[model samples]
Target: MPVVDIPGSKSITARALFLAAAADGVTTLRRPLRSDDTEGFAEGLAALGHRVGRTPDAWQVDGCPQGPPAREADVYCRDGATTARFLPTLAAAGHGTYRFDASPQMRRRPMLPLTRALRDLGVDLRHERAEGHHPLTVRAAGVEGGEVVLDAGQSSQYLTALLLLGPLTRKGLRIRVTDLVSVPYVEITIAMMRAFGVEVVRETVLGEDVFAVPPGGYRATSYAVEPDASTASYFFAAAAVTPGGEVTVPGLGEGALQGDLAFVDVLRRMGAEVSVRPDGTTVRGTGSLRGLTVNMRDISDTMPTLAAIAPFASGPVRIEDVANTRVKECDRLDACAENLRRLGADVRTGPDWIEIHPGASAAAGAEIKSYGDHRIVMSFAVAGLRVPGISFDDPGCVRKTFPGFHEAFAAVRAGLPG
Candidate 1:
């Protein structure tokens, strides 16, 4: 058995940063993730004239109660979609102009839905390049925020951006969500907002989901981020793939805020034993991996983890209802099919689902192309635990979320029998 001390949640760290910056006083974030995405967000916040101090243990952010000091600022988001999508709304709360740019991969991701919602809230935004893409400009005099509708099918970050900015609006904020995917992430945003001393009212009105936020903005407080469940999925999948193997991810237990923690239930359904305590959660393989048909819409982040273990299972594995996964760091559905095929698995892919047949044998020293997606790299690494000669083309891409992923993974692999 290996105990993995995984990094903090990237989602929670990002949201906590945004909420802290918008709050009325200083906030301390303990054990926040120190990766490219979160660091990029911290940089963006600093560019807006907010003070961000870093220490070995925590990050102290001086909240901008009234608004950002810079009338105009250039925020570079790198490849972090969370930074690109969420920061624009925070910038809009200030009285100034903000230009946002991202890596080519992130620019290809959808931002039109969120930008459109900002425009509806009376923030002047212009897409400098093609429509719906990044390299956009936001000219802000603060948000009017009456009523707006957004299609959250592309990414839950869109709705989360609006909700984070809701309290700063003049008339408060009322949002109608249509085709909302990743509903659990929205819940995460609301929960974090509540911790920052803001309350978001969520209700269903005539079959549509609506969220209401009053004009009283956030108040700063100290917050601690839990270990990233999405990152923990790799080690958990390793345990499920290796017979009699067990891995414990501490600090992410029954009361964790991340929705991706539900991934353990998926492992449980696949014949793995799961134990949850207040301190941590552990998963052990039953020596028999059972393939299952599951809709991973809410927990789509773990699709690659499940796919990595699917080939080692006793039956066919069918993953469905994750069409939103197509628009992630890459077309993950296609990437999973191609990489699985490269590893000699009989994988079939549709517009939304992937069906992997039972038998999978490694093509001698199979090399997996990560397509610059961190999840793709980590997932395939889990498969390597079972099949020998598994290597990655772009192993460094894990730095986007977990900079020490390979090192941590090596620690887990050290416990595996040769």
Candidate 2:
């Protein structure tokens, strides 16, 4: 058995940083993910005059319930959507003039929904280049929160940003969401908010989902981040596609907070033996890979992971209801299809789905176009296991989430037999 020790969750670390910055005292976060995205978030906080201390294994953030200490700040949000979206929202709670910008790719992603809602709440915000896009400024006098409506169909990060800003307001926030995708991510945000001493009331009123967050901001505490389940999917997929191979990832058992952990069930349904215990989760290959259709709306981050291994399945593998993936680091549905065909798999992709047929091993060697998306590089690395001579155009893009992925994955591959 090959036990792959995965790193901490990026989503959890970002939220923890936000909560700690908003709390009333010092907050220590254990095993936080150190990546481009997270480091960018911490830097954004520091630029806004929040105190953050870092070590090899942990991070310490001093709370500021009165909001950011700086009266003027200019934050560059790199490629992290959480930093781009959440940091501006965090700055809105303070009395300052905060200018926010991002890289070309991050600048291209949508920011209208969250920015519109903030404006509706009496925030002075202006878009410098594009409307509802980055390169914006917030002349924050402070938020006196009230009922606001939102549409989170394109991404759930909008809802998460707003929810994080709720408690920092004077009157709290009652958000009425018109649409939502990746519901589990919102659940993660709400649960973490509860941990930081805020209870968000969620209910369905007249057939619409609503979240009511109370005022009186977060309370600082020590929090531990679990192993990233999405990152674990690549290793587990390696086990499922290799003959007589087994891989175990610790710290993502039954009670794991991330919905991406449910990717194991998808592997299990494809003829892999899965074991989820209190300590960890394990997947063992049965050497018979079957295929079926799976709806991956709530767990869409792992869509590329499954798509990469679909070429090895015995039947057609269809993944559906993941349109939001189009707005990720790249158009993931199309990216997966393009690479699958490059490897000689019969592949088709619609707006929200992709289907792959088996026996794609005919191609000799193909270089995968990474599109600067970490998931694209990491997912196809699983495909590289059974299919020989697979390479990447930009393997270093994994620095966005898992900086040491190539070495870690190479070590695991050395221990497993294909």
Candidate 3:
């Protein structure tokens, strides 16, 4: 087995950008993830007047709290959802019209709840094309902070939008969430904000999604983003499900704010040895894996890795508590099941759960389909190392998050052919 060390996560990078942009001083982020999404953020921040630079493994952002005064302008996020959602709210803070649009992929994402909530509180944004979806122009009417309900079950980005814009609003914002699925991501936003000198107080209402954010711009600070736990989950899974070996990931220790970091526990339960480090982490594969049942509500980003490794276990591996996985990049649960089935693993899936019967090794060189999802491709590609003749439909899709995912895979492989 080969040892692997991957770069940090885009999720952490994006959060770092938000924090850096809100801070008053220049923030330097080391090992920041580079991708279309992060680039879009840099572009969006530049549009709002923040000076940013995309350097090797790091980013420099100079933030001005009062600079991006909302103006009558449109910011096109292209295919970047973070940019599409977060930039509009930032723009709305100032007095002016701003329109947010995206490419075909991002254009299909639902934005109704955020828009409706903003409109209700007083954002002057209207869909130039279809309602709920993008291609809309904002008339820049400042929304007074008030109670707004959001259906975050579709995507956590909507909730993140409100949380990010909280400090800029005149009054503190309280959002009552209904059917919010990706609650962990909200916690991620809150944790990152607090690191950069902003805090969002969360009050849990049983059977409801309710969160509150105080009024104030994120206090500018030099905050470094933690390594991406989600990115490390795949390699950790690789170590666990393999016949023998280990993988070490740095910068993710015990009690990381990222919900996906909990995936290490899932690995340990499956009989893998996990070592936590101050700036990194390590995972060693146990010779054999026991099929386990798990709930993934908090660690949905690790769904692909867990599902890919499930078939290698001795018993049935069942993953539950994550219906939100259906919307990311693609219908991940459905896609993983379909592709794994193609590779000769027996798998069953539900709206919120998946049951996998582990017995045989994945077939070699099956030319699996990625469904245009980067996670699907990356996890399954790692699976291919164990299975003979493994290939992906769109090997290039990993650029969405890990721009050098293949290189990282190759880096870990040492001499293994890509």
Candidate 4:
């Protein structure tokens, strides 16, 4: 058994940065992720005239109580979607002119839903180069925030961006979200907001969620981020795929805020033994992997991780209700299907679902194309544990979230039994 210490949650870290920047006083984030996404968020905040300082133990962020310092600035979000989507809402909360741009890949992702919601809230926004994509400008005088409706079917980040700014609005904020995908992430956003001293009132009206947030904005506080459960999935899958193998991801247990922690249940349904201790959660192989159909909408981030292990299952694995994954850093659904096929698995893909039949023999050596997606790179790396000669075309792509993923993954591999 290998006890692995994973990094902090990217989702929580990103949300904390936004909330801290918006709060009235100084806020400290302990054990926050230091990868590309989190760093990009910190940089974006600094560019807005907020003071963000890094120390060995933690990072301290000084809030812009009145509003953003800069009246006009250009933020380069790079490939971080959280930075790209969330910062614009923060920018709109201030009196400024802000332009957000990202990597070419991010330019292709959807942003209209959030932009439309911002417009509804009376923030002046424009798509500088593309109609519904990034490279957009926001001329802000702060949000009016009366009432707005959004279709969050594509990505939860849209809902989250607005939700983060809910309490900061002039007349408070009311949002109705239809076709919501990744509801767990929305829960994370609400929970984090509460941690910063604001409560979001949520109710279901005719199968749609209506959220009410009052005008009292967030108050700064010290927050500690839990280890990233999404990153833990690969190691947990490692245990599920290896006979007599066990891996413990420390610091993620029953009380963890991340929704992706439910991924262990998916492993449990596949016949792996899982235990939740006070310190962490551990997954142990039972010498059998059973494939089962599952709806991964809540934990869709783990879809590729599960897909990597599907070929070794005793039956076919079908994942459904994750059409949202198509609009990620890349078309993850297609990337997973194509990479699985490349590995010689019997794979079929739909607009939203993917079916993978167990392969009788391991495929020959092949290089998995990463598509510059970190999840894609890491998920397929787990498959390499069982299928030899599995190498990556862009192994460095994991730097987006987990910079030391390959080194950590190799340590996990080294601890496994032959």
Candidate 5:
């Protein structure tokens, strides 16, 4: 099988762009993801007058750790929520005001929480089209960051925006959070911000809804992105779905900074023989799939593959703690539930959860709709291998993360028994 390394996390890429734009002097990012989301971040940074140069190895981002975006930005964030969220705050910290536009898909995503929070923090930002969404105008103004509260359960990106930009604000932010989900992602942001010389201190919680970031700015340095553990779950899970073979993802060792790396434990729970190495991990199919109940608060992306493999299990596989799933590229819980039902699997969904009942093997090979979500396309495509000749429409949608997702699936599938 042809083995390839997926670029670093798109989440990391966005954070890196924000870091580069917010850092002093030049910063080099190694192995950044080069997808639409990251590209949009780069474009937005370029509009803000960061000399983000693309190289064969890594990107060289010339930057300044000071107030005001160096230039006028006519940014098209497209469907990248990170670009749509983080860039606005960075723009608010810049030299002059800029106009921010987005694609139709980007237009549909909510930016109100971040916007409202920014407005409360004294940002002179406005909505061009919808009040709470994209097509935003980032006016030149200083953010007087002090205390701000937001409903983070909708999406943790808002919290991330504040944390990343907290140091740049005049007062430095002390945030009070409510309904904050996807905390692992926030932890990643906190960890990465610390890596770049920013400080996010969490004091004793007054209640469950509060967090504190101490006053400090970010440091500039070279950084490398770990290979994507979330993408690796598919290949490892593929080994379990397709019997008689094992798949290994190298370079994803134990104790990764990315929270999505926890998917390895999920595969082990489902009866896959798992071995974790300092360099990577391997998963071999066990004799039978067992029932599982998992709360995927930290590792929601793994849900698609886990759910796809669920129908082969001995009983129901219940996935919980994924209210965050609803606000992803698409509604992953509904997508998994609805699509599995199409294949005659007993699937049920909730506002934020999913359950899959084991069932007979059926190769209907119907055209699966991706809804423009990459994980849905690949996870179901893996399930397609369980039934021969199953294919997907708009399979190219996987380029959002795992650019070679289809080819990688094919390479591994070609090695399996018929």
Candidate 6:
């Protein structure tokens, strides 16, 4: 068995940074992911005058319950949607003028839902160029939170941004969500809030979901981030595709918090042997892969992982109900289709789904065109395991989440039989 040590969760680290920054005292984060996206989030906090101490093993943050220490700031959010969306909301709780911008790719993503909700909450927000996009400004005088409606159909990060800003307001927040995708991500948010000393009330009234958050701010505590389940999907897929091969990843067992961890169940359904224990999880190849249709709305981040390995299955693989993936780093559905076709696999895409037929020969070497998206690169790398001469146009893009992905993946591949 190849024991792979995956990095910490990007979603968890980002949420922990937000909670720590809004807490009443100092907070320490153990085993946080050090990647481009997370580094940009920490830098955004520093730009707002929060004290963050960094070491190899941990990151300590000096929380500011009264909001950011700075009165004015210009923040660059890089390509991290969490940093771009969450940081401005954090700055809104303080007294100042904060201008936020991002890379061209990040600027093109959806921002209107969160900004509109903030504007409805009485914050003076302006879009520097396009409406509902980045390169915006927030004139902050603190928030007097109350009832507001949000549509998180496009991105759950919009809802998460508002949820993180709840306790920082004077009057708390009562959010009525009209529609939501990725319910598990929101669940992770609520659970982490409780860890930092806040209990969010959830209820359904008149067929709509509502979240009631109290006005008291967070209490700081030492937090340990779990290994990223999404990142672990690649290694698990590797094991599932390689006959007689096995892979184990520690720190993501039955009690793991990330929804992406559920990808193993999808693998198990495809004929791989899976084991989930208290300390870790393992996947072993049984030499047979049976394809079937799967709905991956809540865990859409791993869609590409499944798509990459679909060519090796004995039947057609159909993935459905992941429309939100279109607005991610790239149009993942289309990207997966393009890459799978490039590998000579028969692929088809719909508005929100993909189907891959297993007749095409995927063993031939091909160049994968990575659209500056990390997931695109990582997912296609799995195909390189069986297909010789696989090359990537932009392999370095994995730095957004896992800077050392190639080396780690190479190690796992070297341990497996050819």
lDDT (Cα) of model 4: 0.91
Q: lDDT at 139 for candidate 2?
A: 94
**Which residue pairs show collisions in model 4?**
none
Pairs that collide in candidate 1 are: none
Candidates sorted by lDDT, best first: 2, 6, 1, 4, 5, 3
Q: Please, what are the lDDT tens digits per residue for candidate 2 over residues 112-167?
A: 99999999999999999999999999999889999999999999999999999999
Query: Compared with the true structure, what per-residue lDDT tens digits does model 5 show for residues 274-322?
Result: 8888887777776677888899976787888888878888889999988
The global C-alpha lDDT for each of the candidates, from Candidate 1 onward, is 0.91, 0.94, 0.77, 0.91, 0.79, 0.94
Clashes of 3: 16
**TM-score of each candidate structure, all chains considered together:** 0.99, 0.99, 0.92, 0.98, 0.95, 0.99
User: What lDDT tens digits, residue by residue, belong to model 4 across residues 1-418?
Assistant: 8999999999999999999999989999999999999999999999988899998659999987556889989999989999999999899999989999999998999889999889878889999888889899999998777889999999999999988898788888899988788988999999999998989999999988899988878899999989999999999999999898999998999888889999999999999999987789999998899989999999999999999899999999999998999999899999998898888899999999999999835556788989999999999999998888888889999999999999999999999877
In candidate 6 the C-alpha lDDT for residue 114 amounts to 92
Error of 4 at 294 (Å): 0.3
- Give the C-alpha lDDT of model 6: 0.94
Q: Per-residue alpha-carbon lDDT of model 6 for 1-418, expressed as tens digits?
A: 7899999999999999999999999999999999999999999999999999999989999999989999999999999999999998998999999999999999989989899999999999999899999999999999999999999998888899899999999999999999999988999999999999999999999999999999989999999999999999999999999999899999999888899999999999999999999999999999999999999999999999999999999999999999999999989999999988888999999999999999546555688988899998999899887778889899999999999999999999989876
Clashes of 1: 0
Instruction: Give stretches of model 4 more than 4 Å off.
Output: 360-364
Residue 272, candidate 6: C-alpha displacement in angstroms: 0.5
Candidate 3 achieves a global lDDT of: 0.77
Candidate 3, residues 1-418: lDDT per residue as tens digits? Answer: 4545566667777777876776667888888777878787777787766778767867888875653643555576867778877777777776666667887877777788788878877888888788987888777655578788888877788889888877777787899888776667888888888877776777778777677888767666655666677777777776676545667776677667678877888888888887876666777776877888898877788888988878888899999987878867678899999988887888899988998897545555588898778889988876776677888889998887778778787666553323
Clashing pairs in 5: 68-94, 68-95, 69-94, 69-95, 196-219, 251-279
For model 1 the local lDDT of residue 106 reads: 95
Root-mean-square deviation (CA) per prediction: 0.8, 0.8, 2.5, 1.0, 1.8, 0.9
